[model samples]
Target: MTDQIVPDSEHRGLVARLPQVPRDLAQLARFDRPIGWWLLFWPCAFGLWLAGAGWQIGLLLWLLLGAVAMRGAGCVYNDIVDADLDRQVARTAVRPVASGRISQTLAWAWLGALCAVGLIVLFQLRWQAQVVALASLALVAAYPFMKRITWWPQAWLGLVFSWGAPVGWIALRGDNWEVLAALYAGCVLWVIGYDTIYALQDREDDALVGIRSSALRLGGRVRGGVTVFYLGALALWGLAFWLLRADWVALLALVPAALHLGWQVASLDPADPANPLERFRANRWAGALVAAACYVVGNA
Candidate 1:
């Protein structure tokens, strides 16, 4: 049972302690990997902070809950839709759905339950935020099929995952569409860059199974591709800050995050199997740095 756990699970011990059924369910939802939810939540923070909403503790916590629930639900749905493909991928073969530890029926049930939690979080938001949040459902539903039809599925994931920025921004205020657009665009590129790094882990397996990804599409130039995406993200974020406040000091807030992204790109080693996942996980901190920048620039 312990050996069945995924290679990237961060809470193997706690997950291992659970009984078989619950453990499988937890793995199905990727609760063992909190990084997914953190990545989802940070963009919400970026939107809120950059909207000049100062430390909205209650709303932030609610958004955090939504991120965890919705991200889990998204994973469950993805696994169900991609069960056959997942089985062919070495790293994903152990997934509960792919391994048949959980039936599709049960997986759908669990997905509904997780979405129920997201529904509760939805009710906490204003009507505009609610509408903005609900509008992402179509993109989320279509995301699972993207890998089959498109080499750049990460771009679709970007649209879905970076949605919280607009929701958070609209939740606070309806003005400043330009700043919000810039922020959201930056988030989309950031997701593309990080998710491309993540796709490096499955490039060979993906090719074998006919699954497409930006990493596979980029071939030997993956490092340069990710560099381009990251640079675009930073440039858009800088534009957002300038639109919000023309002061030169506002641009300095992004320097730390810029340096962090630079480091990730500089040290990236796509040849080593382990290096890509490490770099991908490091984006959690990168997200934090960007959130801090958002707070400083928005609040200043």
Candidate 2:
């Protein structure tokens, strides 16, 4: 079998060097794709920083590890549930579960291992945060089914993926629930925007296979849809910053992220195969810019 993944997948050279078993494992957990973890980690960072816990290096590192492990676990679970659907999608047909490189039994074991790491990270947080984190399990478990049932699974993903925003804030301090609510709301809109970009890569396959996605829902209006979502994210973030510190300088901290989002919207091309994935992957930097804004507003 060819060792290559889809054209848009990154870390190809690194993945190519790994042995077969490790490679299969890597594919199962999507370890070769760092963007998922980065997206997941950003919400945690935003929450921590926005709660004035940015200086907690140890906590931050723990959250990063948790993001990696939990994101992997989520991917494993999604692959398991979507194996048949994945076999129908060209890009996902080569996935470990879909390709039969990894059995469902082994995949379940791997998911458990990853969740064990997440549990360790959970132990590090306050009980309030722990409870908040655990509350997301049902949502995560149900996510794969959303694409089967709804035209807006990306909306569900936004809720599940942005969960760390609340966890990070509650872990440090439970006050200012308003700010945390705004931050989580902004992160959800941000996820919806980017995931819509990602769903563009699969619009044709998804439509043919009866899989619903935001890309299919928006169709030619995808760029406009993303623009609205991004604009909503910025607005909510601005509101959060205002609530935190009602100063012009605090709100200005969002400028870099605003510019980056604008670039993404302006340059988006749904018809171009590579355009969507490239724009989707660029959210890692978008996440960083948001994290920076959080730190500046919450601490500076």
lDDT of 1 by residue, 1-300 (tens): 799999999999999999999999999999999999999999999999999979999999999999999999999999999999999999999999999999999999999999999999999999999999999999999999999999999999999999999998999999999999999999999999999999999989999999999999999998899999999999999999999999988999999999999999999999999999999999999999999999999997
Candidate 2 residue-wise lDDT at 99: 88
Best of the candidates, lDDT: 1
Q: After superposition, how far is residue 143 of candidate 1 from its true place, in Å?
A: 0.2
Model 1 scores a C-alpha lDDT of 0.96
Candidate closest to the true structure, highest TM-score: 1
Which regions of candidate 1 are displaced past 4 Å? none
| lDDT of the candidates, in the order given | 0.96, 0.92
Tens-place lDDT digits, model 2, residues 234-287: 999999999989898899999999999999999998888889999999999999
Question: Alpha carbon lDDT of residue 254, candidate 1?
Answer: 93
Model 1 residue-pair collision total = 0
lDDT score for candidate 2 against the true structure: 0.92
Q: What lDDT does candidate 1 reach at residue 283?
A: 94
